[model samples]
Target chain A: MMKATVYVTIKQGVLDPQGVAVQGALHSMGFEEVSSLRIGKYMELQLDTNDRAEAEQRVKAMCEKLLANTVVEDYRYELEG
Target chain B: MMKATVYVTIKQGVLDPQGVAVQGALHSMGFEEVSSLRIGKYMELQLDTNDRAEAEQRVKAMCEKLLANTVVEDYRYELEG
Candidate 1:
């Protein structure tokens, strides 16, 4: 089986309200040293395949189709056995 | 200087439309081998501080305040020199 880890994030220019809210909460929790924070998503998948080429092809398709939003998000993945 | 890397993702049971769309795209691209895909975000921050405790406090605050949405997102971060 092949395992893949994917990371996704919003584009820099977009506004992130969620990040702002978390920063505020941290400050209230006696963590006043914080400056800024941004949030993203992570995913892990296990595939039943051994071919690297096939894995890449499928992963790339996955990223382009459902793993990432081309309009506001970018995604990358790492594959391992 | 303190550098931190933050990762954020949608909690399980949350709907990820972006992830779903990417999956569809990948399938069309001849990557039918993929079973599932989830998307998330990654962030790298450069801070001007050296104290580990202080850094942690600040980073944690950032995560809680703005880096993540407690309702729908989860976050984690790493600290480095």
Candidate 2:
């Protein structure tokens, strides 16, 4: 089996309200040293195939078509077997 | 300045509804090669201080106190300056 780890994050210049809220909550909890925070998504997938190239291609297609909003978010993935 | 990347994932045995929904969507989209999928949270933090040890300590505390729900999620972080 092949395993893929994908990260999906908002593009720069995007306003992340959830991140802002979490930062505020942290500060309120007295974690004053936190300067900035951004929150994103992490996904793990297990694929049946062992072909690295095929896995990579399929994973990329998955990210583009369903896992990420390419216009507002950027995604990168790592694969391992 | 320092940057920290934190990954928060649902603990084993925990049911992840969002992950299930995404997996279902992927299968519907014909990515049937995907055997399993899990989703979690990714966070980036920029801190004002550069001390590696202090940063690690603070980040750990932040994760335990705010960034993750220890009851259902486990968090790990990497730091860079």
Candidate 3:
């Protein structure tokens, strides 16, 4: 089996209201040391295959087609067996 | 300056409807090699301090207070200066 970990993050130039809100909340909760914050999605996947190359390719396809919106978000994945 | 990366994930045995939905979608999209899936949150935080220990402690507190739901989720973080 192959295990894949994927991270989907907003593009650098994109606005992240959720991150802003969290930063504001942290500041209000007295964590004034926080200067910048960004939130993203992390996913773990278990695959039935053993081939690393195939797993990587399939994972990339999955990220491109279903796991991430390529227009505004960027995705990267790591695969291990 | 310090950077912290945090990951917040649901506890084992918790039903993740969103993950289920994504798995289903992936299967329908022809990625039947997937066996299991879990989804979580990833956050990147920038702290204005240079002290590693202080940054770690504050990041932990931040996770406990707002990032992860103590009752249902688990959180872990890595810090770098």
Candidate 4:
């Protein structure tokens, strides 16, 4: 078996209202030291095969095809057993 | 500085189109043993202070406000140095 972890995040230049809101909440909660907050996504995938080369290729294809929005989001993954 | 990591994911029973698309890509890549795939978001925030209690509160605030879409997405976080 193989395991993979994928991370997806919006591009830095894009506006993130949710992140902003959280920052505001933090500040209101007496956490005035927080400056910047950005939010993104993480995923774990398990494959039934042990072939590392094939697993990597499939994992990349999965990220490009569905795990991430290529226009506004970027994705990277680490694969292991 | 205090660091917080936020993870956002669609709740169970909700449709995950991106995850489905990834499953397709994985199947095409010849690793047919894959069954289920779920995609989500990940974020890391660096607070300007080292106070753990305040930092946790702030981080949680961030998660509730803008780090996640509470209606459809679920969020969890971890704080570290």
Candidate 5:
């Protein structure tokens, strides 16, 4: 089996309210050294096949089709078996 | 300056409703090659300091105290300067 780990992050210019909230919370908790924080989504997929090239293609397609909002987010993935 | 990328994933045996929903959506969209999917959180931190060791320490503390729910999630981070 092959395991794919995908990271989906908001585009640089996009507004991230959840990230802002988390940063505020961190500062309030006395972690004031944090300059900025941006939050996104992480996903892991376990595939039954072991073809690395095919896995990458499928995962990329999956990201574009369902895992991420391409207009506002960008995705990258790592594959391992 | 240093940038940290943190990945927070659901612990094994923990329930992930969001992941389940996404997997179902993928199946509906005909990406049936996916056997299992787990969704988590990804965070990026931009710090004003350039100390690699310090960045790792602070980011780990941040993850433990705020970024991740240790009871149900596990976190790992990579630092780049």
Candidate 6:
């Protein structure tokens, strides 16, 4: 079996209102040391195949096809057993 | 300055409808090899402090107070320059 851990993050220069809101909340809660904050999505996938090459290709395809928005977000994945 | 990358994930046995929906979509899109799937949140935090220990404690406090719901989610963090 193979597992793919994917992280999908907004590209730089994109406006992240969610992050801003969280940061504001943190500041209100007294965490003034938090200078910046950004949020993203993380996914874990399990595949029935063990072929590293095939897993890589498939995981990449998955990211492009459904896991990420190529225009606004960047995705990277790590595959392991 | 210190950067903390935090990963927040649902605890095992929790009802993850979001993950299920995504898995279903993947299966329908012909990714039948996908045997399991889970989704979570990733956050990048920039701290203005140079103290690693202080940053670690503050980040942990942030996670507990605002970033994660301890009753249902598990969190881990890594700190770097």
Candidate 4, residues B1-81: lDDT per residue as tens digits?
988887888999989898888778767876577877788877778889788998787677767875678888998889898
Clashing pairs in 3: none
lDDT per residue as tens, model 2, B23-46: 999999999989889999999998
lDDT by residue for model 6 over A1-81, one digit each (tens)? 998999999999998889999999999999998898999999999999989999999999989999999999999999898
- Residues A1-81, candidate 1: write the lDDT tens digits: 798997777788887787677667766876555576666667777677998888877777776876678798877789898
Off by more than 4 A, model 5: none
Q: Which order, best to worst by TM-score?
A: 6, 3, 2, 5, 4, 1
Work out the TM-score per prediction: 0.66, 0.98, 0.98, 0.68, 0.92, 0.99
Q: Over the stretch B1-81, how does candidate 3's per-residue lDDT look in tens digits?
A: 999999999899998888999999999999999899999999999999998888888999999999999898999999987
Displacement of residue B81 (Cα, Å) in model 6 is 1.5
Which scores higher on DockQ, 2 or 6? 6
Error of 5 at A16 (Å): 1.2
Query: Which of the predicted structures, 1 or 3, would earn the higher TM-score when compared with the native?
Result: 3
- How many clashing pairs does model 3 include? 0
**How much is the lDDT of residue B16 in candidate 5?**
96
Task: Give the alpha-carbon lDDT of every model.
Answer: 0.75, 0.94, 0.94, 0.80, 0.90, 0.94
lDDT, candidate 3, equals 0.94
DockQ of all candidate complexes? 0.42, 0.92, 0.96, 0.50, 0.82, 0.94
- What DockQ would you assign to candidate 6? 0.94
Give a tens-digit lDDT track for model 5, residues A1-81. Answer: 899999999999999999999989988987777788999998999987878898898899999988889999999999998
Candidate scoring better on TM-score of 4 and 6: 6
* Clash count, one per candidate: 33, 0, 0, 9, 0, 0
lDDT of 1 at B48: 67
- TM-score of candidate 6's chain B against its reference? 0.98
- Kindly report the docking quality category of candidate 3: high
